[model samples]
Target: MVPQLRKLTLMRKIKVDIFRKICTNWPNLTCLHVDFRQEMNYSLMKHIFEKCPRIEKLKLWTTMLIDQRCMELLSSLEHLSTLEVLLDKPHLTPVRLRLLTDACPRLKEIHIDWNYFAPQDFEYFLKANKHTLTSATLLWTVGEAQKTSVVPLLKQCSTSLRKLRLVYFDTPRAMETVAFEALGELHSLHELSMQYLSTYEPKLISRAFRPGCLTQLRRLLMQYTTDLLDETVIAISQGCPNLRELRICASYKITDVALSEIHCLRHLEILELSRCSGLSGTAMAYISQLPTLHTLILQFTEDLAKLQPSLRLIVELKELRCLDILKSGNIKAVPFGEFPNRLLKLRELRVTYESENDFTELQRKMPNLKISNTAWLTEDDFPKDDDADYGYRDG
Candidate 1:
């Protein structure tokens, strides 16, 4: 063992008292990750700061509200570069959040997923310290003043902002209408995702293609926008030509014409249009022409399986390596006989049907392909991050 080659890292699920001992034993620990239930208060945080001064990364998931006291304790950690905090209680006020950011000037990334709805303090925080933040995810509630003023506030981070996520992390049944606009000023953003819970949004995006807004964007995800129409798809294809990945789920109003507008995206690699009702085989007909597309997921889109020609059009996507057609109404009824020639590049396929599904011939086609039904893995494969689960281990 070399004297100067010591590297310290710890990711485990231990009682607080045991964790305190571990911190005491290794004062040079630079990275720490615990389960979501790890309790934190002034006393625990005080001892942590005293013992683990060299820590650079921290993740804590709590079931309590992050009020001023917790903010004060977190503010003392000045060298933190990445922080992720998921709270059970909502409402992180603007003043306290500003205090935390001001206290830690070097923080670059923060991702928080909370229950209920988020307030407008996050918008205020963005306006105040836009330069220090390079990536942030702010999930807010539905407020008239909050929704309209949110996009304009992102302009403050235009200089260094690279990643941004504005989504709804509300309860399962709670839905709120939100209108999206003013993305033209964020030229530096490379990844932008806007997810909502409401399907009745008047218009997903008012005007995203005004020439300069999404010019440098590489990935865009718009989910839960049930009213996403053909015009909006045209706006995305026209506005952000540099996009490599796009996901639009649960879009009810999108038709074949909307997907035809996406034909201009020559550089697109990954695309997912799950549960879009209005689009029949027409969208897949055009999507198969994309030369660079590698992955496609069109789960539960029954309209796409209208005819045999429709299913045949998908096999034309020779570049596609992964395809998910699970729960898609009747694509299986089309008889491809033995399917031994088409889908040469496919490596993975997932599908599910109500009656007997004959995978015998489908397996003969892509002998090397991995196929599975459109269902979640066993509980042991990926454990939940609750009291009993430890989640992912550090790499």
Candidate 2:
């Protein structure tokens, strides 16, 4: 008979004994995820690097302050190729951050807590090691000061970067000109995600039109942003001809006009629109015209019932394979009989409802549907959020 193997992960609190056991037994571990709130003891960190010599990827989430001791231990991991650090307190000194890049010479990707360092410290750290960075994610919590610091870094580091995700901490107008100007120069970038500050305005969407800004982009995701009105959407749809996947959530300004402009996206295959209350039946009618769309996610809309009758008109979507509708209020009133009897290529369908009558009706219409009747799907279902100790995940 074969013996069973054991597994361990750092969770709430990493005691010294647990750390010692992990170090002594998991020497060849390739991936390590640690939460500093539970495992803040410096000795455990020292043991991790000294004993787990084969560890190549590390993700650390720290709820407490980071000091020189943690930095020194992190610097000694000779085999680390990817590192993700989320800091609760803004205290990663410029000296320590620079030491991290220098220590891990082969580092290819880095994700840092955007709120942890001052603008000057961030710029200095980026300037020191722009050559080795392949991808970077920044979460900004401060306003214009952070954006000003980040723009110059993006301009300088754009040459080697292939993916960049930025969460703006300030209003749109504060740093639009410089940030977009820098983005126009990133000729090599291919994937981009942006989360605009709450006070973002729609007029600033024109800044993204700067020539070459999105020429190489293949995937784009925008959240809580503005300026997605008719004109801006038309310009983007025409500009990003190579875009294959598009996700726009909580962008309330988009309307039916934006859907009309999407016809220019000839290569698009996936579209996700969640909490976009402005989209109506007219928008769905226009979306039905897209021949290449294979996956569609419509979630948390206030008036999904109104669009239900239009479903039959779009049933000709030959490539459509997956449909997900969850948390959309009053969706029970939508008539399932309006849909075509045979969705020949449909492989997956997810629907969430509040009433049993709605579930029974939907099951009668689509007997093979996978129905989940939860009031809400919390962060616990996803492995990433359940495991993260310090990094914030948007709902």
Candidate 3:
């Protein structure tokens, strides 16, 4: 009866008969996200393709091995534009990718765990969808032998690709200067996220971007790289003048010098620095210079003394709306009473405090502000900006 239903998400598994019946009733559905545990067979996939003619986005989290028949059936969804397949078995290959991209030519966005496919497979997929693909999430674990020239493949779709996410489990050696040179060629890229694990050389990833290369970039996130330098941040600030959101996590090498350089980004709105121990609170004066800043997150600093002075600088962010200072148990409770009415726009504040009165007093002072004493806050805990595209968030 719900024929007008346009979107649906099912986190839990459903019976095959029930799924088919639901699909039959919601023929106009354009988006579907379902956990197809054991019910993902050719017949079920066929029913979906036949029933949901308007389906544009499809996410299948399954335990079954995806076969050629399933791929072929998915190809029949001519309206499909975004595809996400999280499977227990590694069944996505270059040949399968060709089937989907060739048949469903409208498909432009893909979200997949790159661990399921080889480096060559990824290359082939990018080359195949180079013209139409706009967004891609490449999440993989790097093996020593798997180091390949991925940036060049990404550049093939530079004119069309807008958002890209690269997450590596075991980061390899610092990329040669040539690799980042190729990455800078993505002229149309709007958002980029690079995350690494067990990274030692602090300057490895920073060398990836040269000033004035990624001019179109608006949002950039680097996590656990420990590989950013003051020069790199300065280059980013000078090059990407329009950048609005910037987040760097676990970067121990970035000092107050780099933080001072960020004042060049006049359009910057959100800045998050997590576990960047090299920063002294003195650089906070530079942050207060940003006229457009609304959200600030300085998390996981071990030294409270270094942060106490920085807290005073935050009052200068007249446009500030949200602030999070949650650290891993090391941060002692800091009273919010110090933040006066100077932060007129401030509405939400998150911190780790032991006393209940600290929360009560802050609420009493700023009746409109919402304060949380959460011990931990993840990316999901913070609400995303309303204007965010491609699931990019300030958090």
Candidate 4:
């Protein structure tokens, strides 16, 4: 009988009998997240929506196949704004989207993972939410049909959408240059993360990275775009002058020249580059130019002689607080042990070293610094079963 409770989460498998008994207890709930292994049926959906009439945000994780009746029940929550679906099966059909858009007028932010929507579905979605939607995360597969639809749909919400993450899980294809060029039109965007978007012509991609576009972008992450070049990144620096965080992974064509251009981002605080084998030790010198940079991660070290000086150049970053050299061969080969004493602001260090004696000695010298040997950091993705909340908010 906790009527005052406005948020409820039931991640463990709950029997239908038990769920029904307690579902009505939280009539004031505004946020609800349920992760059930059983297929979420109309009855379960009804029990939640009917009982929690005030719910404005909802996350349904597990196997879900909502029929038209379930959609109607969901739309009953007139206050619903944020929706997250991490289903094991593909259930986001165009008909369901049309139902939600037509019925739930306040629906705005949405995160749909591991689902495939047809090209036409995307157009319908963007057209309906063009004026209200502020954030969207879509982790789906992009096929040939999606090429033409992607650009126009993105343009539809350019003035309102502030955050966009498009992660495609399909064979790498050269997406049209205009598709990327469309992103520059999103003037309100502050964060953009794209993965597995390959291109045959690297030069054409730079057109989207020039100034007067993406001026509000503060964070940018691009992964596995092997064709991304130095010129493209240089234009990104010029375009996103206010960027505070930048991460580029597995893009081997980018070298020190691109890193050098990042100094233009005066507010840059975090920089991470991994699997970029094209960068020599010289890139570290370019990175040192960012006086405001506090956190840095470099994960490629095939040439020890070149990397050693680059490791030394970190001393120039007086505000440096965290340094991660994961999977960059042995840490003992470089002068990493001296960083704690040289950079007084250093507090966390992650490397591939294994010697207990060396770790004890460094800890003894700098008691304030914490060090670890984790091999790789996880890629930021949708929340899982262990993670309690998806951290979404009303728009």
Candidate 5:
């Protein structure tokens, strides 16, 4: 058979050297996901370039070797359009970035997760391939350099960029230090995801959604961004009317007002507001009205009473699919009279309570629904003392 391969995803657990053989066999392979713990030899990597010349989509794991020779080999692959690399010992430098992008003119999506120094040549890479890049994910070791590295890249690629994910690990106030105004300038951007494991400034992030900016944005994900407030939610609801999916996990300041503001987003398909304290029933009422919502996650609410009234309105959501209210203390006992009128499509439901009776009733009534392992959580089980483990999913 002619070597007209297109994609190859291989995870190496064995010590045997089968990868080199596979790469040599597939000369026309376009996409390759190599998640191996073993160190890759230069000759084997070089042979990949020589043999699989058409390898375009490349995703490598954290421990894989990518030395200077490997970079030389990478520079030979001309058809690469998407690249995701998790760097370990040998950090990703701009020189190597330039080498790869210079070789691959069609490279459009670049996702780099590094625990090393911010690549000094980041801006140069952005400038050279700005027109071609539409989706980019840049993650660096925890520090202020993240803002420095990201701000300029966004500025350079503002015109053509459509999707972006910026993560600064264990860095508190990374978002506060960056130029949020630069994000607003990217008019073509449709999807955005921001992750700062330690801390992130939501007010500054909200500034990016002012009126004309991000009007076409469909998806917004801010994991562990606890400062997202009503003001920002209102601004997003106003500016990003086309918003489809929103995830605000472990946010502190968000309340009923914020949900009320975003309830009118007619196009919203998925909403996840987990571990948000200080909410009322009024907010849940607003969420019930979202016409297009398919997946809703309101797990671990501070006040269970606030979520109870909204349970009745949830049945009104004809399109609702997955609902997660686990650890919210909303269901001490399953209410037989207050069951959803029509949950024909409801596939997965998670609740935190120890009751075989509850599970049995739910199963008997809705045979299609999959009630997962009961999360027997008491008030004492709530780890308010440990912020790190507070919202940690049981699964």
Candidate 6:
């Protein structure tokens, strides 16, 4: 019998039972993820930690309330290398965050989903754990008035951080100077994802790409507003020499000039230009010329005819593996047979059309192709609208 086959609703209950069984029968359990709605009672959490002494990776999703016993148990787990916590509350008070950090001195990576927290509490956590923290993800919901404090905390931790993702909510003005100033100090940073709230300004975004601050950065994701200009794009290409993946979807202002600037990224491999209404044939040709480009995504563009002329050159990109041309209402025609057979390396293809006949014709031309109707796909099938929003554009 499997111990009466209990139905566990909470992650904690499942973890407790599984680990208890593992300790009794197996010698080691290395990884655990707990998704529990309510806070874990400290003693029960400690018991699980004591059982899984060899655990190296731990992921916890819990309510806002701090369980001191759980914290104490976590502190005793000396081998923890990766810790990811998703908190239901808006913020983790500084003291509780510090306690967790202090317990895991050997932690190499930490990801936190902070719902509500004081700006200084984050600063204190950074200051206390600066030496041990190498990568951090902070999802913050901050007000307009509290924006100034966010950057200083980031700047303080930038020296030791290699990857930083700052997601802001309801605080656009904070995206300006303070954030960039802190970001510029991150000498070792390789990846950055910054999503600004409604208060984002063009100047602040431009400043983030200023040369020398992001010398080591290879990947950058910016989610801003339509106010971003061509200068910002130029500045980014010039600043990050090793950039390999560039996703600028939903940027209504991107034009031929901005597209041309992307050529500066010699190492670029993947480029996504979805929902960019200003793209033209010239822009498409320029992108097709990227020597290292393997994957190209152009979804929901307003001008499909502009891209039609460049399709031949695009198919000639020998290294191209995946192409997504979905939701371009302007693409009235597709030269399915015209594509060079030499593009044998192509693997994945996505297109959107209302007519089943059009899809059938496309499938007949490329028998190995995988086609998806964007009209039928749900939001989960594609990146979220807000995640795809590239607000910066050259007006």
For model 1 the TM-score comes to 0.79
CA lDDT of each prediction against the hidden true structure: 0.63, 0.63, 0.70, 0.71, 0.67, 0.63
Best by TM-score: 4
CA RMSD per model (angstroms): 6.2, 4.3, 4.9, 4.7, 6.0, 5.5
| Candidate 5 per-residue lDDT over residues 56-123, each given as its tens digit | 78876444534566756777878888887754344444335657657878888877655333344565
**Candidate 3 vs 5: which has more lDDT:** 3
| Residue ranges of candidate 3 with Cα displaced over 4 Å | 36-38, 62-65, 87-95, 115-128, 139-147, 169-175, 197-204, 308-310, 328-335, 375-395
Q: Which stretches in model 4 have alpha-carbon errors above 4 Å? A: 61-63, 114-128, 139-147, 169-175, 200-202, 300-306, 375-395
- Candidate 3 residue-wise lDDT, 69-109, digit = tens: 77678778899899876534443342356567667879899
Q: Estimate the TM-score of every prediction.
A: 0.79, 0.82, 0.85, 0.85, 0.82, 0.78
* Shift in Å, residue 215, candidate 6: 2.9
Model 5 TM-score on a 0 to 1 scale: 0.82
lDDT minimum window of 10 residues, candidate 3: 385-394
Put down candidate 6 lDDT per residue, 308-340, tens digits, no spaces: 576556766677777788777655544555453
Decide which is better by TM-score, 4 or 5: 4
lDDT of 4 by residue, 1-395 (tens): 67789887776777887777666787888998776574478887888788878889988753554565765677788898988776544444433566677767888887775455666656676788888888887643433344343544677644588887765533224545556677677788898876555555667767767799888998887766778889989998888998998888788888888877887888899887878888876777788889899988776655545555675777788899988777776556566566666788988888777676778877888889888877444535222322222212100
Residue pairs with backbone atoms closer than 3 Å in model 3 (clashes): 202-227
Candidate 1 residue-wise lDDT, 236-261, digit = tens:
88788898998888888888888776
Where model 1 places Cα greater than 4 Å from the true spot, the runs are: 1-14, 62-67, 91-95, 113-130, 140-148, 169-181, 197-201, 333-339, 353-357, 374-395
